[model samples]
Target: MPELPEVETTRVGISPHIQGQTLHQVVVRDARLRWPVPTDLAANVEGKPLRRVVRRGKYLLFEFDHGAIIGHLGMTGSMRIVNHEEPPAYHDHVDLVFSGVTLRYRDPRRFGCILWQENPVMAHVLLASLGPEPLSDEFDVAHLLRACKGKKQAIKSLIMDGKQVVGVGNIYANEALFMAGIHPHRQAGRISAERLDRLVVCCKQVLSAAIKQGGTTLRDFVDSEGKPGYFKQQLQVYGRAGQACVTCDQHLTESRLGQRSTVYCKRCQR
Candidate 1:
């Protein structure tokens, strides 16, 4: 699935081409996505100019005059900019046609969504309860400590919870925890305030780095320009379970937490 970095990457990549451009048309090759593409999508957006593309967590908001189009790049979904005359291929499900180019959406698994919402797009149920963005000032040490209060969930799981802090997906969580020297299975409430503070800084650092590198392309992730991310090559503990730790010489360990694969260096992370 495309996480925060991936989603942000797509937003930035496509914004240059579509921002301030008039929407020429809305073409829906398949309306059967995670949810049905809004039946009146064209009526709402076809003639309006796209004001901007903003990202909240993993969802992208295509802002216009009266409303916004909410899009999610689910497990196998991606958006790319193609010439207006380019032919649609298999899995290419939707297109927001513009004067010069088309923003095409493709989803092999159809788990993504394209929906229309009126003003105050954030109030939609899908986004109403989401936590702060990991890179924002709202997701600081103090905020995390409060969420951790009296919680017995594993620190990794707590951080991964959308209601606690959005966009700390499994991969970034592992990397951030390793950077902070916190074990993935540690109790959230049992962690020291100082350590949690460091964890907050590390999470921001890791996420910023991933976004700078165009996100980690474990699989099925590409920028709006169709280029794969290069961050995976720099991973320390997320996928190198049996490999040597980058910090300590000890071998990294792998386990399943919340049913997601977790890799850590036991010697480096307490």
Candidate 2:
């Protein structure tokens, strides 16, 4: 699935082309996505100018005059900008045609969603209750420490919780924990405030770096320009299960935490 960095990259990549352009049409080749595409999507958006594109968690918001369109790039979904006359690919499920270009949404798994929000988008069911954005000032160490209090869940699972801090997905979570030198299985409440502070900084560092590199492309994730991310090459432990640890030269270990693969260095991390 596309994480926060990938979603942010997509938002940045396509924003310039679509912003300020009026929606010419919305073509839905397949409405059976994670949720049914609204039957009146075109009627709702056509002729309205796209004000801006922003990302919250892993969802992309295309803002217009009266409301915004929310999109999620599910397991294998991606968005790209192309010429208006460009032929659609086999998996291109939706297209938002603009004046001179088309914003295409392609998904092989059909788990992505394209929905409309007529009210304050932040209060939408899918967005409500989400934690602060990881890169924002609201997600500092003080905030994380408060959220960890009285929680006995594994630190990995705690940080991955969308309600605790949004957009720390499996890949970034593993990398952040490794960078913070904190064991993934450590109890959240047991961690000292100082270490939690370090963890917060590491999360921001890892996520900011990932976004700078266009996001980690483990499988089908790509920016809105259809470009694969380069951050995978800099990974320290996420997928380096049996490889030697870069810091201590010890073999890294792997386990399943919350049904997600977690790789860590026993010597480097407590």
Candidate 3:
């Protein structure tokens, strides 16, 4: 699935192209996705002029005069800018045609989403309960410490929790934990506030840098320009199990935490 960085990259890549364009129409080649693409999506958005584009959590919000459109690029989903009349590819499930350009949404795995909202988007149920954006003021070390209090969950899983902090997915989680020198399996509540502070900083830095680099492409994901993210080349431990640690020269170990593969240097992390 596309994480926050990938989604943010897409938002940045496609925004300038689609921002001021009016929604001429919606073309739904397939409404069956992770959730149904609303049959009335076109009718709801046809004449709405796009006011702005923004991102929250992993979703993109295309602000319109009266409402907004929210989109998610799931495991194999992406959006591209093209001529409004471009023929739909096999997986091009939807399009928002503008005067001269169209934004095409494609999802080979059919797990993405295209939804409509006629009210404040953040209040929508899907986004209402989400935690603070990791890069926002509300997500500092103090906030993270509060969220981790008394939790027995693995620190990895705790940070991955959307209600605790949005967008710390598996890959970035591994990188952040490795940078913070914390074992992914460490009990969330037992971590020192000082160490947790390091984690908070690493999470923000890793995520911000990944977004700037267009996200670490782990197969399926690409920028709106169809370019793969370059951050994967800089990975320290996510997929380097059984390899030598970059920091300590110790052998990196692989284990499972919260049912996801985890890689860390036991000598470097506690």
Candidate 4:
């Protein structure tokens, strides 16, 4: 699935092309998605200028005059800007046509969504209970320490929880924890405040770095420009299990945490 940095990268790539441009048409080749595409989508959005574009968590918000359109790039879902005359390829499910270009949404698994929300888009059910954006000032050491209070959950899983901090997905979580030298299996409540503070900083740094590199593209993820991210080249732990640890020259270890792949260096992280 596209994580926060991936989504943010998409938002940045496509914003300049679509923001403030008048929507000339709406073409839904397939309404079957994670949720049914609203039948009245075109009526509500066609012919209006996209006022702004932004991201919250992993969702993209295309703001308009009266309401907004919310988009989710599920596992294998991607959006790209294509020429208006370009033919839709396989799995290209939806398109929002602007003056001379089309914003295309493709999802092979159909787990992504393009839905409508009223004026206060944040209040939408899909977004209402999400935690603070990982890159936002609202997400800080104090907040993470509070969430970690008295929780026996593995620190990795705790940070991955959407209600605790949005967008710290498996890849970034592993990288962040490795950067902070915190073992993934450590109990959240047992971690000292100082280490949690280090984790908070590392999370932000990892995410910011990923976004700068256009997100990590292990597979099926690309920026709106259809470009693969380069951050994977900088990853220290996530997919390098069984390989030498970048920091300590020790062998990295791989295991399962909450059924997701967890990789760490026993010598480097505790």
**TM-scores, one per candidate:** 0.98, 0.99, 0.97, 0.98
Alpha carbon lDDT of each predicted model: 0.94, 0.93, 0.90, 0.94
Model 3 pairs whose backbones collide:
none
Scored by lDDT, model 3 comes in at: 0.90
Q: Could you report the Cα RMSD, in angstroms, for every candidate shown?
A: 0.8, 0.8, 1.0, 0.9
lDDT of 3 by residue, 1-270 (tens): 789999999999999988887888898989999999988788888977888889988899988877788899989999989875568889999988888888999999998889988777788888999999999988988998998899898999999999999988999999999999999999999999999999999999999889888898788898998899999988999889998999888989999887888999999999
- Candidate 1 collision pairs: none
Better structure of 2 and 4 per lDDT = 4
lDDT of 1 by residue, 188-264 (tens): 99999999999999999999999999998988999998999999988989889899999888999999999999999
lDDT of 2 by residue, 96-125 (tens): 999899999999999999999986878899
Off by over 4 Å in 3: none
**Model 4 TM:** 0.98
* Model 4 per-residue lDDT at 43: 96
